[model samples]
Every structure is written in C-alpha cells, then in structure tokens.
Target: MSGERVGAAVTWGLLGAWVVHDLEELATVPGRLRRNVPQLRKRFPQVPERVWRRAETLGAAEFATAVGVMGAIVGTASAAGRLTGGRSGLYQSALTGFGLHGVMHMAQAAAVRGYTPGSVTSPLVVLPFTLWARGRLRKAGVLRPPRPRDAVAGTAAAAAATVASHVVARRLLGAARRTS
Candidate 1:
C-alpha cells in the first residue's frame, strides 16, 4: 500500500476505536451522574438539567471528534515526515499536534460554556483515548519504531482532535435542539 494510504488506515482505525469508547461512556454517563448527583448538587446549587444533558451529549461527541482529528493529524504528519526524510520533521509534527490539542480543548470548553469555556477539564476527559491511541501506534506493525516525537505529536494531535470533535458535535447538537 502507498504511504498516505497506510497513514489514513491507521488514523481511521484509531478513530474507530475511539468511537467504541464513546459509546461505552454514553452508556455509563447516566449511572455516573446518578452516583454523583449529591456532590453535583452540593458543589453547584444552581445546576440545571440542561447542563447535565449537554455534558452527556458533549462527552460522546468529543470522543468521536477527538479520535477523528487526532488520527488524521498524526497520520498525515508521520507520512509527510517519512516522505521528506527530514530528521526534525517528526518532532515538529509531534509538537504541532500536542499544541493543537490545547487549542481544540479550549475551543470545546468555550463551546460547552457558550463562549466562556472555563478551566481545563477536557484534557482530563479525553486523555484515555489519546493515550490508548499512542499505545496502539507503538504496537501496530504498520507504524514502526514510534519515537519520542510521536509521543508529543500524539498528545497535540489528540488535543486538536478533541477540539475538532467538540465543534462538530456541538453544531450537530444545536441542529438537533432546533429541530426538536
């Protein structure tokens, strides 16, 4: 297979895995909320049902989006680096991906908060899948000799994916809300 095709395959594979994780989280959100209700109420006396619902929706959307965006960024970067045969290309890609994560997450927070997106909670939420992708990349036969640069790239890519997913998911949510 061609290099770009290989990269795309890896990206899609990782994204698919993330979607599965999203589904699992959605299934458990209700129980998680039930368990945390008392604390939620105590912590935020003015909490609303809409907030809980939004959280649930965003959680699922973000996961899928993150996976998609991160996978794309990483695969593209790695492939490009390999094609060009530049030593720092991979590191540069990784750094870019890592930084992108912060951006995506911040955007998600803003979207969730209606423009004021508060402190950093997204990184915490998306970390699992991001980390999982990294692990998978290392083990996969197609993508060999994962480097330190990859770790950085993986992180940034994951963050960017988180943000991208959030934006897409939020738009979908808005459309659904309007129609419903």
Candidate 2:
C-alpha cells in the first residue's frame, strides 16, 4: 500500500482495536476488579460503592468517547501530514502512545498471571496492529522508528487524556444520578 493508504489503515486499525479492547473491558473489568483487586476499596475508601458502580456502568461510554477523540486527533494529523509532505508529529505521537498502551496491557496481564481487562486482545490485536502501523509510518517517512523518550511522552499524554475522560464521565454520571 502507498504511504497514505498505510497511514489510513493504521488509523482505522487502531480505532477498531480500541473498540474491541474497550468492549472487553466493559464486559469484564469491573467484575474482575471486584473479585481480584483486594485493595481497591481500601485504597479509595472515600468512594462509595454506589459511586463505584456508577463509574463502572459508565466505563464503556467514557472509553468510547475518549477513543473517538483520539481518532479525530490522529485523522486530522494524518491528513495534515499528507497535505504537508508527511510531517505528522501528532500521528507519530499517537502511534507511540497506542503501541505503548499495548505493552502496558501485556504488563498488567503478566503481573496478575491472568487475564486483565483488555489482556485478551492486547497482544493478539493491539500490539500487532500498532507495530505494523509504526512500521508503515516509518516506511512512509511520516515518522521515524519510535524512541524510548517518544514512547514515554506519548504514553503520558494518553494517560492524561484517559484521566480527563474519566473525570468527564464521572461528572456526567453524577449529574444523571442526581436527576434520577
């Protein structure tokens, strides 16, 4: 495939992986956490059970919205890169961010010695897709091979976005609860 086509495929593949990963998390994460993470409630004693449940209920929506935002950013950056001779910093950042996210999921699974929320598909889907996308981006001259620092920074940015999404979700859920 041409560079632009490769980039577009990477973008779409990342989004698809995210949707599947989030669906896996939504289906199982809260229940798994309740069962496995012994210190969860103890660590956040201030959060009531009802609130926790509400957050859990909203998890999928929050994840979907965040992924959508990430997609828009990547798509816009990719388009710009195509228009401007393939200098897409945001696209590179996203590739690094998502690639590292796959690694994080694998690490989480390894630490627990079992399946964690997104673990089932992280290696099988996310990692491979992200790796291929990174390679395509490099071959296309849209980005260089990811560096350690770039990955770190990208992951940090992604983490911040995740936190922001959670905050927004919480507020929305809280409002809905109040109205009900």
Candidate 3:
C-alpha cells in the first residue's frame, strides 16, 4: 500500500466510512420502515402493536436528527483517532461498535428475509472497510486484541448511544412519534 493510504487506514477513515454507511440509512430507513412495516404487521399479526406504531410513525426529520447526533459522536472519535494515531480508547471503541453494527445489519436483513436500511452496504462497504481498517491497524502493531468483555461493552455502548441519540432528537424535534 502507498504510504499515505496506510496512514489514513484508520483515523478519519473511520468517520468517512461511517458517513457513507449512514448516508444509505439516512436515505432509506424511514421510507423502508414505512413501506414495509405495514406488510410486516399484516403478515405477522403476532408483532406487538407498539412496535408497529413506532416503525410506522418514524419520520425523516427525526431520523435525520438522530443521524446528525451520531455524526457528531463519530466526528469526535475520528479526531481522537487522528491525534492518538488510532490509540485512543474512544476511537477504538467506536470502531468496534461500528464493525459490530454492520454485522447486526446483516443479521437484521436475514431475520426479515429482505432488504432493510443499511443492508445493502453492510456487506459491501461497512464490513469490508471495517475488516480492512482492522487489518491495517494490526499490520501497524497498534491493533489491540479485543477482550470478550469489550464486545459486550461495545454492543451495550452502541445500543445506549442509539437510544440516547433518538431520544435527544425526539425531544429536539418535538415530534409526536418517539424516535427511540
């Protein structure tokens, strides 16, 4: 790899990758849920009424606000990654969460047996880019081995962050539907 490419494999690249993946979601999520949830509710009447209500009611405005909140977090993590040469806990934690997020997207798609927001890029851009970045970090001798507890913490952190962002967005937008 070129020297410059090697240098950029992790830091700002993390945020860049996230932006690309999230852009797909920003464009598709609200519409996908709106279009699909009704059919899902019809086909699977066992689904809880509240679950259908949330999915059906999610608006683009609230979803975009949540994305913006997450963008800020990822931006801060990227800055820390740059300053620390990818050694920052904040950056690495975000990276771990991001990679796992892609896996969850794939699983989500599989569960539904159809496309969902983020499904298209999860294998194409998200998973591959995350693998490439981890490989680059390992080659540079900076990739810390992840502990099992780290996985748990990362997943919990990701879920918490998602809920917090949506909650913040819901309050900020004053939307009738709770994005969270």
Candidate 4:
C-alpha cells in the first residue's frame, strides 16, 4: 500500500480499536469502580452515584466522538504533511498518545490487581494496533520515531479528549433526557 493508504488504514484502525475499548469500558468500568474502588466516591464526594452511572452508560458514544475528533485532526495533519513534505507532528502526537493510552489501561489493571475495563483488549488490541500503526507511519516517512516530547503531547491530547468526552456526553445525555 501507498503511504496515504497505510496512514488511512492505521487511522481507521485506531478508531475501531477505540470503539472496542470504549465499549469494554462502558460494559464494566463504572460497576467495577462502584464495587471495588469505594474510595472513588470519597475522593469526589460532589459527584453523585447516578451521575457516575449516567456517564458510564454514555461513555461509549462520548469516547467514540472524542476519538473520532482526535482522529480527524491527526488525519488532516498526516495529509497535510504528505502534501507539503513536512513532518507529521500531530500524527506523531496522536500515535504517542494512543500508545500511552493502551499502557494506561494495563497500568489501571495492575493497580486494581484485576480485570479492569478495557484490560482484556488493551494488550491484544490497543497496544498491538497502535504499535503497528506507528510502524506504518514511520515506514511511510509520515512520522519519525516518537520522541518523549511526542508522548507528552499525546498525553496532553488525551487529557483534552477526556474533557471533550465529558462535555459531549453531557450534551447528548441532556438532549436525550429532554426528548424523553
């Protein structure tokens, strides 16, 4: 495949992986947290259980939207980089961010010492897919090997996505509630 094709495949694969990850989280994260991580309530006493439940229930769509938006940004950057013969900084950042996200899933499972949401697929799906995508990008000369700075940028992007997901989920949930 050409570079663009490879990049596009990788981009879409990332989205697919994200959807699966979000679905996994939606299925189990909140209930697990409520059952196992009792300290979560104590840490955020202002947030009600219903609110958390609602968020968890809506997490798949919220995360999908967030990942889609982020993917668009990275995809655009990749296209622009190819056209202009420039470095794909945003694409690299995304790769780093997503790779780290997979690692975070593993870490969360480790901390809990059990199966955490997304844990089942993190190693099998997210990590491998991310690594493969990064390899493709590098081979295509779309991006260099990721640097520590890229990882930091990616982490920041992930943080921003979290906030965006919450905002989007709230709006979606609110609209649904109003309609009902």
Q: How high is each candidate's TM-score?
A: 0.37, 0.73, 0.86, 0.69
Instruction: Please provide, for model 3 over 32-132, each residue's C-alpha lDDT reduced to its tens digit, 9 standing for 90 to 100.
Output: 88989878898779989998998888999999999999999889988988887777788878888988999999998898898888988889987888888
Each model's lDDT comes to: 0.48, 0.67, 0.85, 0.66
Per-prediction backbone clash count: 10, 0, 0, 0
Compared with the true structure, the alpha-carbon lDDT of candidate 3 equals 0.85
Q: Residue-wise lDDT of candidate 1 within 110-130, one digit each (tens)?
A: 644532221243354334434
Q: What TM-score does candidate 3 reach?
A: 0.86
User: Following a full C-alpha superposition, what root-mean-square deviation does model 2 have from the true structure?
Assistant: 4.9
Model 2 quality (TM-score): 0.73
Give the C-alpha miss distance for residue 84 in model 3, angstroms.
Answer: 0.7
Clashes of 2: 0
Question: Which is the better candidate, 2 or 3, if ranked by TM-score?
Answer: 3
Cα miss at 111, model 2 (Å)? Answer: 1.0
lDDT of 4 by residue, 86-166 (tens): 345655565577778889989977865777788888898889978887777667666576577777888988778667756
- List clashing residue pairs in candidate 3: none
Worst 10 residues of 1 by lDDT: 1-10
Model 2 agreement with the true structure over 14-58: per-residue lDDT tens digits: 566666766776787656665654455565577688866655455
